[model samples]
Target: MPLLFLNEKSWGTACDPARAERAMADFVDAVRAAAAADGPGTALVSEVDVKALEIAEGYPVNKWIGVSPRHRVLWQRLRGLQGRSPVRSVFPTENAADHLEYRHDGEVVLGLGAAHFMDGIAVSLPVARQWQADSVALERGELVEDDDGTLDMRHDTVVVRHLSAEPHLDGHLEWIRKTRSEGVTTGPRIWDSRADLYPHLTFLPRVEGQLGSLNPHWVLSVRRALERLEEAVAAWDPATMAEPEWRTKVSPEGETRKRVCRFTDLDGETRTFDLHARFTPGAGRIHFRLVPEEHTIRLAHIGGKIRPDL
Candidate 1:
């Protein structure tokens, strides 16, 4: 959960722990119902949600996608969160929305800036790429938007990352209840996949916008991207998911601006990944296909792959 966890502190008194828990439960129940519903609100976004849920047991579908953020509105309905800080804010001398971030037993383990939890997991992102606002800083006046202005990150700025996967609600609630429970306090623009579809820098929204408008076509393209991502995940051996780290290396080759990376799997199998950038969406931003798949780091990047090896 990077952002979109409304900080309960922002809600002042309305941010009750028990109430928040109740709200979380309610939100999840609503989502499950909504997932089953076929009318209205079931647009492009719903398509993504329902499809992922449908495939929950089929593949790597139930790892929690982007549902956490959607349920934020649900909690607001249950408990009218307070927004106006009794004190002055860094940017808005006045606070606006009243939302509970998230908590477990009592303490604020993690406050969802704009997220809701169902089952034991939370969603991280939307592979479909709607250019929505993802987050905004709580203490700091940092605005983290998506490629498009569809989301209002100004308010969805509370969240946590790197949480240990909790098998059940009891564990998750404990994590949220403890202020110091596997905590990763952060500011805006941070990228820690403890939760989310991918590792997105807080500035991803801004960066994506510079590329171009995010329309259905772009979203559909993102669907393609997800397909690629899923393919990678599927092809990835579970051993790679656990221990035996895998690595990829990319390098530029002459005029081709080539990139070469290799996947070093747990089985000691190395799959050479090489790509030549033939296009870029914005200026020098390279946007091209890959020999194996459209996922490459850079002409010469030894760090994380330009795209996840999967």
Candidate 2:
């Protein structure tokens, strides 16, 4: 005999008292029909317990049952498992199985638990097992890439990118998406390698200028590049800060085009800090002075790259 386990939660909350009673009656009729169709020799098992009813009372009854007569009949027959202790009913043996389960979603409508035997196309345990396996694989980021080579970042990928305790990480990602969507092409790019540092920096629309005002579009690009620099600082890795692609170098004098602007450290010794720059197309240059510490990099100055002599 096959066992049908009704989800007590679904049964108790989905229908009102009157509807529940009617659903139960319809369920009995359906079981009887199923048994009759299977012939006289087959036996079916229907079991329900009191615990399910207790839990079902706390849930809202599924009102969709009343809207469709077919749904009401089917749901009642499938999930209507309310009764006293060890409620058992018998119908026909053709519905018998080694295992039984119901699906709230996806293909395999009803699953039967049992090994292969001398019977015609009986539902078996592996059907349900395979469904569960496929679901797990999908959840684990085993996504098939479309022809365009795009795939959603999985939960694990998001976790890895979430490096800071800052709350506006999603906002940064949204800004990047928006910038790309607008087709604004200005960059000596900064986020290529140090994306992990974006959350720690503030992206101002424009920085103070000494020469002439910076272009708004160019400022936006500079802001993004500086954000990448700030991210590298927050990561506190020298290799990341010193990467050749980041354009880290000594500030240069305009007349001589030579490095200058040396700083004196706390030890009374003069030390030169590397300045980072990103050349904006037709918009001159933007420069940054990095003030390094044990754990952070402070932005000493940010503005248009003016001549050191000036």
C-alpha lDDT score of every prediction, in listed order: 0.27, 0.33
**Per-residue lDDT of 268 in model 1:** 57
Give the per-residue lDDT digits (tens) of candidate 2, residues 57-151: 43323544454687567555534432222212321133322122222233222212111111111111111223111011111121222212354
Tens-digit lDDT string for candidate 1 (1-310)? 1111223232222333444334344434433332223222221112122222322122222222234654455434323322222111211112321222333333443233223321112322221121112322223122222222232323223333211112222333443333223322221111232124332111112223432333211222232233243344345444334311122111233333223344343235454434322111111111222322322221111111243332
| Candidate number with greatest lDDT | 2
As for model 1, its CA RMSD to the true structure in angstroms is: 19.1
Candidate 1 lands at a TM-score of 0.20
| Backbone clashes in model 2 | 13
In candidate 2, residue 49 scores what lDDT?
33
Supply every candidate's count of residue pairs whose N, Cα or C atoms clash at under 3 angstroms.
Answer: 33, 13
